[model samples]
Target: MNDDELVNRLKEIIIEEEIDIIIVGEPVTLAGYASEQTQKSREFAQLLEKYLTVPVKLFDERLTSRRADAATLGATMPTRNRDELAAMFLLQDYLDKQKSNNF
Candidate 1:
């Protein structure tokens, strides 16, 4: 979907789920350098911030995919499931830092 469609869908989900904040995963290199994908994620987060009423924050998502892969070792899983697992790891990392007052 395009940006407009994504924003509209996010709006619906926000209202439906009573979402107060949005945590966007910022994919960066292991060395903490920005890549093309990092720039894209930053731009997307900016777009969400501009269009959504809720606050949008970007959190480091380094190693999330690898962690997800390790978690599902020797198992056959769909790409969508692996992506969802990576998202879960990203969110959990964000929440952990937030809980510790480190973020």
Candidate 2:
């Protein structure tokens, strides 16, 4: 879907789900340069932040899909590197970092 569609859907979900924070997955190339996907994700986050009251944070999403795929391997119904699964891994990592930094 396009960025506009994604932003609109996220707005709807934020309201419907009463979301407090938004964690955007930033696509970082292994070489450390920004790829087209990174640019698109940044644009999406920028658009989303305009309409959101809560904080919108970008998390590094390098290899998250691969990690998700590896984690679900040997399972009967793996998520097949689904975007949601990747996002979950990103968010979990973000949360873990936050927890660690809290100390």
**Candidate models: Cα lDDT each:** 0.94, 0.84
Model 2 Cα lDDT, one tens digit per residue, 4-80: 78777888998999999999889999987899999998987888789777789988999898877777773545454
Instruction: List pairs with backbone clashes in candidate 2.
Output: none
- Superposed by TM-score, candidate 2 places the C-alpha of residue 53 at a distance from the truth, in angstroms, of 1.7
- What is the Cα-based TM-score of model 1? 0.94
User: How accurate locally is residue 39 in candidate 2, as Cα lDDT from 0 to 100?
Assistant: 94
Off by over 4 Å in 2: 1-8, 74-81
Q: How many backbone clashes does candidate 1 have?
A: 0
Candidate with best TM-score: 1
- RMSD to native, candidate 2: 2.6
